[model samples]
Every structure is written in structure tokens, then in C-alpha cells.
Target: MLYLICSVCLFSQSTGGIGIRATESRGAVISPVTAAEPKPELSSDRAILSPRDEYSSGGNAKADRGTVGHILHFSDVHLNISTSRNDSESAAIPTVYGKDAPITLLVSALAYAKKVLPKPDMFLFTGDSVVRGNMTEEYLAEVVEKNVKTMAKYYATSDSNKMKDVTTVVGNADTNPGYRMNLTDPTTEENPQIALIAGTWQDSLSKADLDLFKRRGYLAYALDDTLTVLTLNTLPYSPSHEPNTSDVLDPFGQFAWLNASLAALQSAGQSCFIVGHIPPVISSFGGSPMWNETYIRTYKKIVGQYSGIIKAQLFGHVHSIEFRLPLSCSLGAQFQRAGVLGDDAIEDKADLVPLFMTGAISPIFSSNPAFMVWDYDVTTHDLLDFTVHGGNISSTSGTVDWQPLFKASQEYGVSTLKASEIVNFVKRAETDAKLLEEYYFNSKAQSRLQSDCQDATCQAEWLCSLYWFSTVRDYDACVAFTTASKSNTTTSTTSTIQ
Candidate 1:
């Protein structure tokens, strides 16, 4: 278990460190461009501090900038179980494939998280918690209840064995078209989660069935004027054109209920943490024009419609952290977005410049499965800070340590942390893709060379040795090495609401 300590020392209330650290926010720092503008009151604008406050993790010289709410979020847990009929045969099990194993890694991640921070106010588990979103057929009461109990029981923490008054949301992989059956249909059956609001079954549960889940009882264990947690369920496969699918799937009736709930809290000056499966839009995964944009537009329509009350949207489907604060009309968390960066199948591809988007819990990901612990500041009532502990998630932590994950990544597939290596590999392939194979020939006879040359993998490596020898610069070889990498081959497909 890779334990993490997200230790926070609130030495001085005023000088919370986030501001100074955010010097990079505006890109390079400059002298008091002008006297800093007076801090705006909550009435004038939304809290400047983000949830899981990044701006609060101050390095700022100035103290007591203002009050803020903090949040610690986890998303995209594609947790898998040995439910596949294919798994009935031991030969089909993954241990023999020489590929990365999932069971041990996930256990390690869980153990790591539990070993760390004592507790967090609320734990948010976004969709895809159940791999394939098809744990057991709804008709099989024993199977359905067992699956729900196992899941809730599997990742639970706290004396209550609850992850948090955890606000859970549904993800695409959680349910699909064929998998869905009408909530009221005679064939439909339901198994209650210990207590959490998620689409009864991703797509399988229509909006009404989901609404029924909400109405059956409080989705949140504790709900009152003091706190309001909204668990919204938006399916992953809704078509691009319909923004109001909620009316059919689950009526925005829940949304209206949320609006009223938020109003009551707002009127009382109480704060709220609204969690959901999907974050609005940075762009859909592939930058599909319609995919993310529709969601963004729909999110705006609903949030804007309730702008008077709702505070922020918390979510975890992307499996990556995103601290997005819409400059126009902020919709989500004050902290933008955040996720623990390293986990199986997915590496926290981070640009340290703005790190929130890099962290998220990874279960059934890259090779490590982990979760986070958030310390909520009771004094300020803000999610102050969080620490991510890798679950029995060592690329080898269970049997080995981090090294095995890296080694396995190379043998089975590249680890996410090896982005630079991936870039290089792709670029090398791009030359071939571009039909520039003439650049190198593997013919042993034509390329015969001295032993040292033979020791080099390719002409490119030998060229490097020549440069080190200063015998010849081989400028073209050197220049190609640098220039080929300069051009970015990857495209941004994510949608931006702008």
C-alpha cells in the first residue's frame, strides 16, 4: 500500500498559502501591477477559493486573503470483479497473460488509502465504480443485493463503514442502452445501496427510477440546513442533440428539489457541496464535437436555471482532476477540479503549472488503484486538504513495489507516467506513418558496422556517441532528433464551454 500524508498546517488563518503559490496563475509574476483589488464579498461574487482549495494551499506572503471552501474529490473508478463468464475458466485469468494484474493492485490502493489520513468529511465516488456497470441482473435479488453490499462494503471507511456521506454519481460505463430496463417495468427489480443516490443502474434506470431512488429516502445520510449534498445522475450515452433528456430519464424534478434545497441553504447562509458523475466539459474524451459540448450546454442550462441557489458541482467520471472555474459564470467547485494523478491504466498526465487536473483516484486503472482522504476544516467548513494513498496498487506494491508497475508497463504496455517516452515512441512511428521509412534501414548487410555501432540500437544512438566524441557533430542527425520532437502530434479533443 502506497500511503500518502496530505498533512496541512493551518498556522495562520489569514495567510493561507494558495495565493502566493498561484503566482503562476497569470503566468510570470510582476510587481504590484497595481494595488490588489479589494477582496469581493460573497454577495458580490462567488468565493475566490476553490473547493479542496488549491488557492488555499498558500505560499502567499500576504495573510488572510479571505474565506474559502475546500473539497477532495475521486472519480472514474472502473472497479472490476471476476464476474465475467469468461473468468469461469482459470486459464482465462490474467495472471498467466504476463499482463498487469488487477486484484492485487486494487487491494494495495485501498490499503494504502486506509493507512493514511484518519477521515474526510465527505468522500465522493464518481461513476464506473462497477466495471461494465453490469454486476448482476436486477431480477436476481440475492446477486443484486450482494453486489451492492460488496461494493459499499469493499471500499468503505469510517465507523459506519461508509466512504463518506459520499455523494455518488453514475458514469457511462455504469449502464448502457441494452442494459437498461424500465424502472416500473414488471421485470425491473431494485436493490438499495446502504444509502447513496446513484442511477439505480446507469442507463438501465430511467430518470423516474432515479428520482424514485431520491424520493424513497434521503440520498445523503445526513441532510439538513447545515449541509446539502446533491447526487446528480447523468447517463454517459445520451445523444448529443437532447439536453433535456433528464425529463425522460430522471426528471429535473430532482433538480428542482435541489434548487429549493439550495435556496434554503443559501437563504440561511449555509454552504453546499453538489456532487455528480460527469464534470461539465473540457471537451469529451476524444474531443468529439457533440459529445462534451452537449453535456456542457445541458449542465449550464440546469445550473444557470438554478444559479440563484446552487454553489458548486463535484464530480469524478474523468478519472483526472480538473479545477475549472468558468470566468463567465462559474458552475462547478470553487477549486476548479482535482483528482489523484497516478493509478492503473491512467497516469496523472500533469502539467505542474496547474496541478488540480492531475490528481484522481485510480482503481482498475494504469496498475494502481488508490483513493484520497480529505480533511475538512470544521472552523471554516471548507474541504481544506486531501491526500491520495495508492491502494494495493503498486505496479508491484502488493508483491513488489513501484518498480514492478513501471516494469510491467513496459512489458504489457507503457505506464501513464512515461508520457515523454510515449511521445517519442509515437513520433518515431509517425515518421513511418508519414512513409518516411527511408530514414532508417534494418538490413544487416547494408548497415554492417563496428561492434560499437552494432551496440547502438539505431543510427540515431550512434550519432549521439559521435557527438559525444566530438569527432563529427552529425548536425542533421542531432537536429532531426530535436526537431522531430518539437512538433506536437497529439490533438486536444476535449470540449471547452468557453
Candidate 2:
């Protein structure tokens, strides 16, 4: 295996094994590090991005053979430019409100990502930059333009809160429907995609992205080859059961061009990394599903056509850390299980493809608030390794002894709830759920419950039951559990996306 030297900065310690997981990626397989086990709980989702080819009706014509090494990404900012923000820490539900903190939080996290990681070669902010997509063209234009403009001056910056260079995408929130870059949220929305291509944001010299590159906090190498990133304005709403003509550019368009691009890039000894807002498809969770069966098939066909050249995928939409496991994934599989399609495929290529989510930047709960790093070896034009740094936004405002979200990421081994460390945690969540249930004692509730508490009549017993349930869904369960019996519907009225 060839090792490429990529660094966010001119300086970086080797990630090669004997100490961290880098060793495994390099060669040596070390035993999993054991720690005070956390309560075993249900799992969460991960996301990824891709672009359409010449076949789509929308513009994103199939890209040429292009690969940019080492890209760092963050998404679903819901920056709360105003006071409103994305909602509570519940993936099962939507939340919207005035957090009054996400703004500062996102800013600080961006600073931290720059301060700690090898200054990235390129920084990508995936999407949902604002709290809501529905706004006046003026509000949309002002918000997107102003914020994007300021981003260069401050994001991932720190000359005591300075700014840095960043490349951005037009997330669904960044535009009106049909690829429209709201001149201010236009009343007459034209084909948005074409509008953006023609907008001032695209001017190459120092428009917005340029001034950012001049910042000193972090740096990136401009690949000789044009690296293409595709941002899809997926849909207006999460309509159940398949998308419509309004969704894609053209049937012969997006996917078709995608295949051709992969072929072209590979033929040129180049690689392609897809970056978008929604994951293209995901697990059963639906709503802008990340990667579904159709996606998997299409992806494999395209990558296979290109001779397996995609190196790493950095994304953020979902707040937690999740990697889309390879198809037919069974529980209790190794990290590479999802990376490799099968044993034969593993034999074909020893490397595991990158599918990383940059966690959240906003101070919203659930996410520990963080950014990511991409150490690309300029000489080899290949990414050497990647790591995630957890952080918080509050430090900017005041001084509190706070640590990043988790001491450790990558929850290993399928948790059985029978594990000693998890038993109490599960019970605790269930107990909270019980208390939540009784709060209403009479309204609508979360229906995902697997079992009901038999001793619910006893307040003590009910408390324990609710506690057990709380561990899995966070407050969504609380809000849902209470809904059945309570008149108060305000528990979780905020939409996480606004």
C-alpha cells in the first residue's frame, strides 16, 4: 500500500498506528481500546452527497475528470442568523425556534476546526445555512450573500477570531426552488440553477471565496485539476413515496452525466468526491434519504466504471457521526464491512472508501458541535488520512471548563443493552420516559415503544420506565410520550431545520 503525506498545515504528527486508529488504516490491527463502557443504545444515521450528470434537467452537467484532495465539510448549520434556530436534540422529530446561541456556537466551532486541525486545503459548508428555506428573495439574498461574505472573514479563523478561506455550495436553503439564487428572495422565481450560474457569487476573482482564501488560519493546495462539488436542492418538501419531475433536472440528465464524469475522471488518472446537502439516500429514516438501494446500485456502477477512484466523502446533514455502511450490512460487522461490498471486492482493493459526516457546527444539542480535517498529500494528490475534532461554541462568549461532545467516537460492537455499562443508562432513559408519559397521562405519544411498563401504576416504577426510553430518542420521545395524554403540545414545537 502506498502512503501519501497530506497535512492541513506544513506541520503534523504522523497518524500511523501504535497509538490511534490510524495504525489500522495503515496496517497493524490493534485490539479495540476498552474504556468505561457507555450505556448501549439504539443507533443513529449518517449522510453523504453526490451530483447529477448531463442527464438531469437541472444544470449540474456531468463533471469532467477532476479530483481535489483533502476536503473538510460541515452542514445543516441552521446558523440562526436571526434569533431562531434548528430544534432540539431529536432525530426522530423536527424542531425550530430561537436558540439565541447557535450563531455564536457555529462561529466558535468554525474557529476551533481551523485552530486545531491541520488547516484544511479546502473547506466545504454543505447546506441549510439558515433556519428556513422560505423567505423573501431579499431576505434570502441578504442572508446568503451577507453570511457567505462574512464567512471568508471569520470562519475557521483565529487571529483572535479571524476568518479563513472557504468554498461553499448552494444548499436547499441557499436558494429558492429551481436553482434560483434569490436576488433578495424574488417573487418571480426562475430556473434557480441557471440563475446561480449567472449570479455574482460565481465571479472567480475575490467575490466571496477569494477574500477567504487570503486568511491565514488554514491553507489548501489548489489542485491543477478542477475538483467538482455538486449541491442538490433536493425537494421542496419531504413527500412520501418517490420524487417527481420537479425534483430532478432530467432523467437522462443527473445520473447519466454522473456516470460519464466518473469514466472521464478515471481515464485521466483523476478521482471524484461527491459533496452535496442530502445524502442522496439513507436508511429507513427517509426524508431526503441518503443512499437507498437504487443509489447503491447506481454508485457501484459508476465507481466500477471508473475503476474505484473516489477517495473520501465529507458530509454533514445529520448531526451525529454515521457512515453509510456498504449494502447488505449486518449488525456486528467491522468498520470496513460497509466499505467493502464483499470479500472479493475487498480483495480487489484493500482500501476502505471514505464516508465521513462533519457533525454539526451550530450549538444545537445532540451534536457535540465540531468540524473536520482533510490532510491531502499534495505530491501524491491523494488523501493520507482523516480525523474528526469535537468542539463547542460557548468558549468564545465566556470561559467554562467544557470538553467536546464525546471523549471517544465510533461506538463499537452492537450494544445488547445486556452490557453492564448500558443497563443503567437504558433504565435511566426508560425512567425518564415514564415520567414523561405520566406528565400527560392521557395524550398522544411516541409509538416506537417496544414494550410497555407493567408496573406503571406505581409512580416510582413509571419514572424508571420513562428513564429507559429517554436514552434512545432524546426529548422527541418525551414530547411524543406526553402527547397522548397531555393537552400541551408545546414540548417540541421547534423544527430542527426551521
By TM-score, the best candidate is 2
TM, every model = 0.47, 0.49
Taking the tens digit of each residue's C-alpha lDDT, what string does model 1 give over 139-187?
A: 2223222233333444433456323435335454444322232222111
> What is residue 53's positional error in candidate 1, in angstroms?
16
The C-alpha RMSD of each candidate to the native structure, in angstroms, is 18.4, 17.7
Mind giving the per-residue lDDT tens digits that candidate 2 earns over 1-498? 101111111222221211111111111111111233442322111111111111100122212213323445666666545422123422212222223223445555556544443344456776656545455555455555545544554444334421233444445455544223212112223334324322424443333333321211011222335333333233321222133333432222334444544444555666555665544334212212343333433443343334245554555555544443221111112213323223332211212243445555543433344455444434334443233444322333431122222211122211111222222322333335443343222110111211343332332233222221101122123333333323333232321110
Off by over 4 Å in 1: 1-74, 84-103, 133-163, 176-211, 214-225, 240-252, 289-295, 301-312, 328-368, 383-386, 391-498
lDDT value for candidate 1? 0.32
Query: Clashes in candidate 2: how many?
Result: 82
Best by lDDT: 2
